[model samples]
Each structure stands twice: as structure tokens, then as C-alpha cells.
Target: MSRVVSRGLSAASGMLGGALAGAIFKQVWKLASGKEEAPQATSEEYGWREVLVAAAVQGAIFGMVKAAIDRSAAQSIHRATGK
Candidate 1:
């Protein structure tokens, strides 16, 4: 069904976005805290392992946040619709 496919795609997109945000957030945190000594390099200089780990963390955070947001949004919409 198109609905099922759309749901799957939405989930995949959410995970990917979360992972990307997490990785960037991790890198930015490092840079901001002065933990990273060298200037930032391009993606070619960054390894996959670091990115994967960051993405995992980010995905988890995003998942939790997304759940809360969805719940609240659903509740608000339901109330508006008198459902």
C-alpha cells in the first residue's frame, strides 16, 4: 500500500536526519569545547566509525524527541478536531 510505503520512507528519513544532526552536533560540541585540536577537515579526513557512532547517538536523541513531538502534536490535533 502507498500508505505503508510512505510510513516506511518517513521512518527512514527521520533516522537519517537524526543521525546526520547527531554527528554534526557531536563535532560542533567538540569544537566548541576546545576538545578538537585541529581545524576541521573535509569529510574525506573523517572516518566512517566516528560518523556512525555519532549518528547512533543522534538517532536515539532524535527518536525520543520525535516521539514526544508526535504525541503532543497528535493530542493537539485530536482536541482541535473534537475527536
Candidate 2:
């Protein structure tokens, strides 16, 4: 039962983490690149460098946020269940 509950919590937190990461990425991108929005790959105005850099930064932010959220959820479950 606890395992099921933990899995559910983890899934929910993963979604929340994604949303949080997106907002953070936007702000970081704006500050770093002076652009309100990151360039899309299909945008002819942006070259490969801009698109690739944005992708890398976004991926790093998302990965870190997901890891932090998952770790926190696991620790909470462990503390509650002693498992």
C-alpha cells in the first residue's frame, strides 16, 4: 500500500517539477540571453547555435529539478514509513 502511494506521489511531484523547471528556465534564459523567449529550432531567425544552447540549458535545468523533487519525495516516504 505504501509503495503504491509513494509511486503516486512521485508521479505527481514529477509533473510539478516540470512546471517549475519551465518557469525557471525561462527566467534563466532571459537573464542569460536577453531574450524573452528561447528560440525554436524552426525559427529561421535563430541559427543552430542559439537553438542548441537553449536546448542544453533547458535540459540541464529540467534534469536537476526532477532529481531534487524525486529525492525529496523519497526521503519523505522513507521518514513516514521507515522504509
* Candidate RMSDs in order: 6.9, 1.1
Best by TM-score: 2
Residue 17: error of model 1 in Å? 11
Model number with the top lDDT: 2
lDDT of 1 by residue, 33-71 (tens): 455532243466657765565556556666776676567
In model 2, residue pairs whose N, Cα or C atoms come closer than 3 Å (at least 3 residues apart or on different chains), thus clashing, are none
**CA displacement after TM-score superposition, residue 11 of candidate 1 (Å):** 15
What does candidate 2's lDDT look like per residue over 16-75, in tens digits?
999999999999999999999999989999999999999999999999999898888778
Off by over 4 Å in 2: none
- TM-scores of the candidates are 0.44, 0.92
